[model samples]
Target: MSADSMRVRRSFSRVWPVALLAGPGLAWAQVSPPAGEAAAPAAESSASAGSADEPVASSPSAPYLRTQIGMVLETRPTYLGSPNRETKLRPVLGLQYGRFRLSSSRASLVESSGGGGQLSGASVDLSPRGPWSLNAALRIDHGRGAGDDPLLAGLPEVRQTVRGRVSARYAITPSWSAGASLSTDLLGRKGGTLGALDVGWSTMLTPAWRWTLGGGLGLADATYMRSYHGISPEVAAATSRTAYVPGAGMHGVGVSTGLTWNVSPAWRLGATGAFGRLTGPAVDSPLTQARNNWSVSVGAVWVKDWRD
Candidate 1:
């Protein structure tokens, strides 16, 4: 390996833990109020442009643009260890321009919503069909510091990373979709690569209420597995933990369900719950204490539509 590769590996072993966006487990729905009617925007409502599950609505004379702002609350593992839990309040922002979209928050690709990940940085989308979309994104993966937990005090600090991802989504019907994604280390921060496949279904229960369901499979490469789960002998001796190496393969499976209510044309309310389990090396790693991962999020969004 090159010197840079060695350095990256060392840094990988020393890095700390951070949060990931709970993708594949959430869904979204968009509904426009009856024609010739308008609704007041609520400060805490959820309304945004159409996602993958629906076609992008448009006007004959103007490009469609919408902006969404909101906040989400969730509890997730502090690191990969699962022994520590962190509850965080994450701000949400999403924008749409014609066939282009941008957002910091994530939704499953199957729902044509930007699938889950961290709630920072930005992602861009391109759709060539009413039912298919492609996306590229840059995001921050917060690193972990050994000192944050006694069990990791002597380990190296994992620094924050800026990584990139490319993904594609397809809407099979107005209420169902499927997609895939690939993410890789862009900043060379020892961040590894990840791949995933997802499917989702959404429907309207009433004129104002909608619900969605989704599931996914996750895969990791050897580099990602070793960087995040591998243990070195020297360090194992120091920490008195067995040195182990993990191989790359299928690593996780997840499911998500969500509900949304349109209070008005401009305001919306939504909530989601997701459950996931680690498999293969991720669960077998010495650093891991549990195999189950779960989260819940609730938020409201207010949308502003612009004509150009």
Candidate 2:
């Protein structure tokens, strides 16, 4: 063969291998597998990608298990009318687990005329499902000086009071709710039992602010006339002969209003005022009529949320 012919044969041989090598990729680009087979790998890849994103969904569950704790301080310079005047400093602590919350408050009141001391209480609030919620609390209040009567002399005293309240609220609008509460108080010597029924309207004025107004009527029956002014032995002796006095059974109406502002995600401030008037056989008595009173208080509250 001539040299040119030999070179042409070598070039042809090189071109044939290159063509063979490119055939598979070109065919792959132009042709597709059967619909079922082709779709499967794509579906699998998509699923694997989705699985990688699955962990992001678990983020929401973190709030449920997270614990929220807070401390609060409150001061009430004077409540009602007591000669000594009053100041109360209360420290509050709370823990929330899911929809259940457990809390306690310790109150110390100082009276210039009479020495001041402490009162403490614990409460549990639970909301299992829906808009319904329940709350129960037990409180013990201890202080010396005048009891409930402004006219009476101070008495050395120890008293235990337990209170339970249950309420049902239904949302009337995005910003308003209507609710009612049944509350009972059991007082232990110088002790009495009081039952109250209250209906209220609550409104959310802003995202972090709310207001409530409520009114109720209640009955209080006492075993003895426990006066803030200690009953002199003479007065007790005079009343002792009478087994039960019709004047001791009293019924009254009460009204309350409160405002709460959420200062931040975890801090809140609230002010509340309440007034009551007695209207019954007991009200005619000088002592009972004088005891009709009103009280005002301002407090700071803190709340935290936990979810699971």
Candidate 3:
């Protein structure tokens, strides 16, 4: 009721509303966790989500571009002639863009006949997307022998090859698919054409591994010469032989199998084996006949991108 008491009461009344309005906010501020703890779980959850998304990182694109460049050391033991031996150091380059692939390879026979290396080849492959994927490839190769080299001097030759393949796949399960392919090859010669056909089955052993097994028949005409050698002009002129010594128009059967392993998302390793037997008119020719022999090759392949 006194002046001092009334003045104190008036001041308290003015501050009460503001204090009441700030109470809940202040309580919340005090109860909140420290900055580090409050942000810890959020950061952890975000990292987990990122980890979950990684498996799908490679699936976004179609018609990916994959490329491989590597060297292959080959050993050939003389089957028909003298004990011919050669070591080759080769440089190989390959490019794949979308559904198309191109490659070229050159090798120098380190100790062999010609001053110029023996063999070189170039190939192009096309694989387009469709209900059934179709793959086609063409290759050309040449081999030359030095004048002094006894075994290959008469064998200097150029060869062209064409191959076509059609394949279709059906998914049997989430992790398994069954597919079949039909393939054929045509060899061009100065005299005639040689043709071969193949049918094969491919199975996916895992997401990163595959295997193929196949067999086929081959037929060649009189002028059909193998790509590895050229008939000597002197012999051809004297013998008036349009066909190879073994003659032409021969038939043979062959079997082939291959395995591919994906070492990483960007690299692969492959091994292939082939065997053949020759029959028919040309079989009599020492050079034209196919012998029961097996060839095996292993290679490493690399790819740049999997996106279109």
Candidate 4:
């Protein structure tokens, strides 16, 4: 086998395990598809497997370290579905090598990666070039605690739980795509199953500027609903709130939009915002302070990379 053939084979070998953990691929998890969408991995794998004996050679592009450093300012609700909001200032830093990228969902090196309900955390893209993108991520779900709010004083103190997620996104077009992702409580603090369905569009305003808009539908099973939105009988009695139990259904809908400017090869700037509204049983719960939530983010990015 030639060097080029060997490289593809090696890539396939590394990617299959991720595919298994994720049940194959293709589905929108949250985030932007890297500027240069990966080459079609399935097609390349198939073509290469059939011609393993063919002699071929092509110089590999010199590897380069791509890094982004900056700061992001974000504003959103104090809690999910909260009527009040707060603003946060966070540092932005990210790096990518070959097919693997390490970055926050907002420390974008490509373009905007927000949907209606994006969570901030660390994530790694474990996908090859193509229509499919997959990510393994970890985040903190700061569950509500007693006294955290006057209304939640008597309710159980939901200890913060670390969480993990596996998601996939498929690009249906250069400007359209759809995806689904599943998240689970890694520490098992009763943060039941949560999911999101993503669909979005992007277009260039100029050679160096782009616009993106995307929608995400949120879903939660009984456990997640009960923990985050429900008022149990015992808790309701103590707190004098109405007792309610919720089942699985479409819990919310959200829309996110962004304006990104590629000021130069090493400098980028962007602004993004999202609006979300709770639906289904979650909307009917008495504990719900409000059915609507929103957030906005702005950032400046400086990148260190060498290549076209």
Candidate 5:
């Protein structure tokens, strides 16, 4: 095979597992139709009062204030360990001001700045060219603590870490996009580097409904692998656990699918489901019991268009 073909094959191999996790959800969420076909009613709603034979006028775009709130129920392994599951209720929020956006779901923010450029909680991007754009950012990983779970009673705490990342994305088609990111813990809190690649697509089923699907793979450097998954002799002796050092490798993968329903021009509702699995060192860690995690959520959004 040609070099490009080989690269594509390798990429698919890495992403296949994630796709499998997210694939079935597509069928479950496919209760809609073509995106273009879904917008007719919304356009008609904005028209001025007129006879059927008169041309319907279109409204101009305006600045708006938007916010969302929701509750999520999720099952996850206790402290990244313990086969036992913990059910938790989480509150999620999203807000938008002009070109600025903030999402409690990811604890992040994004805004347009400096003449059409964009800035996000972790990165920045200049004007996008054609179907491609590049961005860079710094991220924080609030490391784990033994006190976070009973299963981690004797394990050492993993402190907060700061990482820098660069990413590039391309529009594969009007409805699909793909991207990859590279990141490294620049502050040495768990000194390591990681990479990921993902693809996503969305479609509108009706004037009120839309859904999206996405999946990705994760890889880590030896330092990152060891920091989060390895047990040193001293730590093993102190904690009474086996000492096992993990090497660099693919750590995990996951997928997600979600749907949104526009209740009106000012109100919307959403639901999402996601699944993930741990592998490599993360799976081999003495602290690890269950390698799989899943979550589901539902929420609503409210918006106020500003005439100013």
Candidate 6:
């Protein structure tokens, strides 16, 4: 192998065993470097007017690390539409080389929502990624567990499974874009699918600071709705709520915002917030303890470009 290839392999070897966004078992939000944080703008080029808020590019074989290693504060429902809320603190980490990225944050391709979520996964572009891009990812969903709450303790378990996603994004302008994503259970776990459409806008407040806003509409299938929302007669008897059968439709809508700062050449800082609400059958389901959801994350990254 060439020296560059050897160096790339060695870099990955060092980080492979140290789980972060790309790590194993721990399904924090998937990411290499926080996907929520757009990289600082590079020199104005021929594509500059069309590709707003895109990350800096490295050679396909070059090794690089883009990570936000700090605590993330997120407040979300204990379960999908559960009324119960839990605030969690997790560390953020991301590793990238070429067009590939590995992250623990589920906040994947759909930018208009809070996060696309699941676990660390590898992503590759299907077409040349630029103002228009098509990408695919394979990740593991740790699945929902039996909860301590009496309301959720009796529901059918959401089993761990492998998931696949295909997403496409089109830049409408330098500061605005639109995208769609679909996720499905590859393991045939009866885990249905989730799909979303979103529009995003970003602007550079200063040479070192940027801000973004986005909105999304979500949809799910009957199996998905039934798995999470439909309560069985036995579960109804145990939870003291009427059993429900849900037909899939509009899942909900969401809005999100983020800020990223180029603190230095080697460091970047970012913060993001999102809000969502359950709609259609989800709101009427007994298992949905809460109809609204929200979360926030903040962190900083130390970057190293092997080619640099």
The per-model lDDT (C-alpha) reads 0.52, 0.34, 0.35, 0.54, 0.48, 0.55
> Which is the better candidate, 4 or 5, if ranked by lDDT?
4
Q: Which candidate, 2 or 5, would have the higher lDDT against the true structure?
A: 5
lDDT of 1 at 285: 79
**Model 2 per-residue lDDT at 54:** 10
TM-score of each: 0.72, 0.52, 0.52, 0.72, 0.67, 0.77
Instruction: Order the candidate numbers by TM-score, best to worst.
Output: 6, 1, 4, 5, 2, 3
Off by over 4 Å in 3: 1-64, 76-92, 104-136, 143-192, 226-248, 288-290, 306-308
Residue-level lDDT tens digits of model 1 in 78-109: 54445666666665566544334445433311
Higher-scoring candidate on TM-score, 5 or 6: 6
Task: Please give the lDDT score at residue 188 for candidate 5.
Answer: 79
Model 2: residue 289 alpha-carbon error in angstroms: 6.3
- Relative to the true structure, candidate 3 reaches a TM of 0.52
Error (Å) of candidate 1 at residue 185 is: 0.8
Largest lDDT belongs to which candidate? Answer: 6
| Model 5 spans with C-alpha error above 4 angstroms | 1-73, 79-81, 95-101, 107-127, 304-307
User: Which candidate's TM-score is highest?
Assistant: 6
Cα distance off (Å), candidate 4, residue 150:
3.6
Q: On a 0 to 1 TM-score scale, where does candidate 5 land against the true structure?
A: 0.67
Better of 3 and 5 by lDDT: 5
Across 100-204, the per-residue lDDT of candidate 5 in tens digits comes to 333332221111211111221223342254666565554344556777667767777777655565666666775666766676767777757776666666566
RMSD to true structure for each model, in Å:
14.2, 29.9, 27.9, 11.1, 17.3, 7.7
Q: Give the poorly placed runs of model 4, Cα more than 4 Å off.
A: 1-63, 105-122, 306-308
